[model samples]
Target: MEVPVMFTLQQFVDAPPSEVVRAFTEPEPFAAWFVAEGFRTPADRVRIDVRPGGQIAAVFVGDAEVPFTLHFGALDLPHHVELRFDDPAEEITVNLTELPDGRTQLDYRSVGLTDEQQAPIKPGVATMLTHLAAYFS
Candidate 1:
């Protein structure tokens, strides 16, 4: 059996889970930090429906404009969320834990990727999270 290329990343944001979750569910905050350097997720092009079976759509504009839609698998507000990429086989799960110090611990995991797939995605995710942390700062 072929193993899926997967990765998990954790970060502590200096904000509560409610604020962290807002960054994920809100288009403006999402667009602000969801992209790597040289790429942009335009807030105007983002459409979000935050609920089970709902979807978020956005266009990542760089040298090319790539449109993608993520289908919501599960949404536990301010706590957990699962989103499936355009291909249902690929999914990302995000969990937020409330820290005692008024911060939030975020756990992010991506599964069902091939080696070729990880090349861009892994780095992109890292950059996205970095930008997210900076957004909260």
Candidate 2:
């Protein structure tokens, strides 16, 4: 069997699971955290059927307007969502956990992709997590 590629990132947000989930799921709210400040980017499109085989697309509104699409391969409500990105060979798994003290921990892993040409993600993710923490604080 071919093994999938993996990408890992963990972030602890001040918000509860319910609020964090909303921030991640709802387009406008999700943009506040997922996209960078002064980005002038719009969540061009974020559609989720919230079911297996659902489709999603996010187009960053910038000078380049880069876009990404994914097909939801699996989903477990308020817990995890698995999707295959534009690259069929890759899979992204996102997990969420409720921590004590009304905090939420989000763990993201991607299998089947190479970051050889891209900036390493760990530090970048940490930066984004910091943005999220501040945004939700």
Candidate 3:
């Protein structure tokens, strides 16, 4: 059996948990910050149905247009969300914790893949998290 590879990228957003969650769950804010450097997710292609088994689908426009969809797994308002990507067969969890200073600590985790599977994804996720943090700055 192959070992499951897990990686977590954390960022401190200068906003409340609700806003941080909105940046991941809402279409407009999601499209703005949920992309890697030099890539854009078209707002028109983003469909955010925030329910279990629902989906957030969008096309990443870059050198090539890649269409991807993240299926919703579980949702705890302003706190936790679980999303699964079909092609890569990865489960992503977003956890938001409100700090004492009122900012939100966002933990984005990806699991259920091999190290090789996650190698290319880690950098893009890191870049996306940086953009998300800057969105609130």
Candidate 4:
């Protein structure tokens, strides 16, 4: 059993919450910054319904293609999102708030992760933030 590991990441981007949130909700922006080192999302990626009860779909790269399914659970408009990654027994909740200077503050908290399981991804958040910085720049 994986023990819950409470982890939080905060990022301040040079864009309004609305635009940053839109980039997250849109498929093109998602695939570009969401890619981890070991995973690959297709170029033809398209996000289906992003509202509650919608499915986030993607196909892995190469011949050994594996499909992905993430379900949008709760959505609080241009502020928060709750979802679950189908292949993993995990839940995801992301929150965003607009700063006074047109900057967006993204905060994420994650649980249910084993040390070994999260070891590799410990650096992934930083990698992702770097991409987000470039993206919002």
Query: After superposition on all CA atoms, what RMSD does each candidate show versus the true structure?
Result: 1.7, 3.4, 1.4, 2.1
Mind giving the per-residue lDDT tens digits that candidate 2 earns over 1-137?
44445668888888787777665566666566566433433544665455688766677666566666667777775777777766545676778798988888988776765565124544555566676667678
- Give me the runs in candidate 4 sitting further than 4 Å from their true place: 62-64
Clashing pairs in 1: none
Runs off by more than 4 Å, candidate 1: none
- Per-residue lDDT tens digits for candidate 4, residues 57-84, read 8776654666777788889868898777
Q: Per-prediction TM-score, please? A: 0.92, 0.76, 0.93, 0.85
Best candidate, TM-score? 3
- Residues 1-137 of candidate 3 have per-residue lDDT tens digits of 67888999999999999888887678888888878666799788898999999999888899988888899998998899999988778999999999999999999999988888888889988888888888777
User: Runs in model 3 with CA error above 4 Å?
Assistant: none
Clashing pairs in 3: none
Candidate 2 RMSD computed on C-alpha atoms after optimal superposition onto the true structure: 3.4
Candidate 2 ranges with C-alpha deviation above 4 Å:
1-4, 36-40, 115-123
**Model 4 accuracy (lDDT, Cα):** 0.73
Work out how many backbone clashes candidate 3 has.
Answer: 0
How many Å off is the CA of 64 in candidate 4?
Answer: 4.8
Candidate 3, residue 88: CA error in Å?
Answer: 0.8
Worst 10 residues of 1 by lDDT: 83-92
